[model samples]
Target: MASPPPPTSSAPTGFSLRKIAIPAFGPSLLFGIGEGAILPIVPLTARDLGASVSMAALMVALISIGSLLNNIPASLITMRWGERWAIVVAGIWSGLGMSLCVLTSHLGLFATGCLMVGMSQAVYNLARQSYMTEAVPITYRARALSTLGGVMRIGMFIGPFLAAAAVHAFGLQAAYVIGIIGVLGAAVVGARIPDLPVPPHPAGQDAPATPTLVSTLRDHRRVFLTIGVGVVLVSAVRASRQAVIPLWAEHLALAPAVASLIYGLAGGIDMLVFYPAGKVMDYKGRRWVAVPSMLIMGVAMLLMPLTTGFATLLMAALAIGFGNGIGSGMIMTLGADHSPRHGRAHFLGVWRLMSDIGSSSGPALLSLLAASLSLALGIAATGLIALVAAAVLASSIPTRRTGAGGAHEK
Candidate 1:
């Protein structure tokens, strides 16, 4: 397949996205909430089922494993069924998974349900991103995708609170019930999305053959190897941020309630920066946000081990949050920018795979280092990785500036 043309200044003026907002982003919010509600309880459920601490950790890891294994297949499914239907199917599948979690007491069955939900998430996320890449104009792409990210954050932020309420009212299993409701609601919302129009060919012109996954990967290997490495490290840092704050809070002997409040505040900060981050990426080019975001997170991670008090730890956690917040939607925006028109889904699958690998690996690396050495060393190493990611991004991202209507000019 031919390379994509240089970025153009032809995006239509006043191309408002208000019409497609709900259909584009609504299901994601519901899905995020459901997934978030269940995430905090998965390990607890495993322990209740008689699994050891290590085994319970493994059970939580299964979700990432499931997502990693399904990325390519999810793309194939999206290609065959289209994005809207793919989302609907994924949501239904997630609902089924949640039902299993709610009904089953067996450990193996519960693990299967977790795996299924993760697999469904892979499909649901890819389909939504693919849909938006095509539906939104390039000039507004960053804002659109960033808002989508923010929406998911909002849902996730709301989810745990809802789960807590439900757990207080009912029992532990009530969280999974909430998940079932959320996924089913997402499915209902997904069903309402209007079908995306297929781009028409010019009269009397032969249509180009659609690229397969293998061909897509082969063609995009350069970008994958370069910016892709940066993507992996970026995901690694983001994932490690989740682990570092809690571990440090524990290390400092902070109260559980205090730790939760600090983490919650960090999440709130993270949620607030998505729109501004997108604006920077769209108007100033990706590097302006990507490089500095990683740098801040990297510095925060390096400083975390030195904190002996709650106040200090809280500051570090918030720094990490602010850094990560400003990088919202960056990975998806990069994927959208580089994807070929003919096999976009296939390319995005590879992109998401790299991201998932980093997400899964980050926590594992932390566990290994913390177990073998010390927690401080592990966090410091993660900080080093984040710094490396920043350097990689600085060198790899295009230096072109985005002008009016998203035009790229060197």
Candidate 2:
């Protein structure tokens, strides 16, 4: 197949990300903050609403389910309305969802609201990624997407503290208020950004007919089956990291506060590495970061089984975080790389669906193993998955290099 054309930009010489940063990434930050603020409180509120423990856990899972269900629909919406408006609509939709959570005491109504928020998240996330894929030059693509990832992480990090303060000052429902503010804020920001002009076809040449999601998937089956499977494993390992640290910490009998501190420390390290990782991907290659990231995480997971104390657990957690952090934009970047210009949104929707599948399944796989066999074995299974992810990525990622001008050549 012919190489994809280099991305075109209308910006003058010496383009800087600052010009598009707020317009491109601002809404994501606001949306993330709201989601984060409400996330920790979801189960607590569900319990207060009289849900059983398992049912409350299901309530939390609804968000991922909602996201998974809406991926294709979200892509359709973005394709129809364009990225900016899609984001605006999604933000407003999420705000309304949060409103339901805040206003309704009915358990069913509350669950519906959680589902709405999750669905909106699917649209919101896909829109931003699609926008960045089109708007950012390929040379800077990794860095731009990494920055977007980092920005969201910062919002999530800030959110719980805001939730804590709000809950303390008001009540449990007050946390939803923060979420309401966040989504609405994102909507407003999204509405204000100028719409990106549709890229023109060559003179005398007509634009190609838009492709359907089914057709796009059929055409890209090879990529989806190969690199896409790798993506699933990558996501699975990453999601398992969240469960492993806390579960293992509990097993080791560490204090809850100490566990939280260690988790927070690992998160801090995770947040710090995004830019450097992206830079390496842009300058060297995707494999430079992707392979090592999985390898490190795999090694960390394997080591986690042996940690018997706080210090050792901390070391394991930090390794997991670092491994995850360095690959912050790996999946998004890969999706963008493989996405056809004609059906980019549709392709991305499917790509994210694959990712969400891994995210939803990873913890369940760990739990199943833990329940049926042993915790150590469950964690080790994830480690094995991570190692497999590394091998798949190393072998499958094309060796094409992106030049300073954003041109790619094998």
The lDDT for every candidate, in the order shown, is 0.88, 0.90
Tens-digit lDDT string for candidate 2 (1-410): 22345543322367678898888778878988999999999999999999999999989999989999999999999999999899999999999999998898999999999999999999999999998888888878888898889889888998899999999999998999998999899999989878777777899987788799878888899889888999999999998898899999999999999999999999999999999999888777788889999999999999999999999999999999999999998999999888888888999999999999999889999999999999999999999999999999999888755535444436
Candidate 1's C-alpha runs over 4 A off are 1-5, 403-409
**TM-score of candidate 1 versus the correct structure, residues matched by position:** 0.96
Candidate 2 stretches greater than 4 Å from native: 1-12, 403-410
Query: Scored by Cα lDDT, where does model 1 land?
Result: 0.88
Q: What lDDT tens digits, residue by residue, belong to model 1 across residues 1-410?
A: 23443555755666776777788888878988898899889999999999999989888888888899999999999999999899999999998988887788999999999899989989998998998888887777777888888888888888888999999999999998888888888889999988888889989999988799889888889899989999999999899899899899999999999999899899999999999999888787888989999999999999999999889999999999999999889899888888887788999999999999999889889989999999999999999999999999999888754434555646
TM-score of each candidate structure, all chains considered together: 0.96, 0.96
Q: Give the number of colliding residue pairs in candidate 2.
A: 0
Give residue 13's error in model 1 in angstroms. 3.4
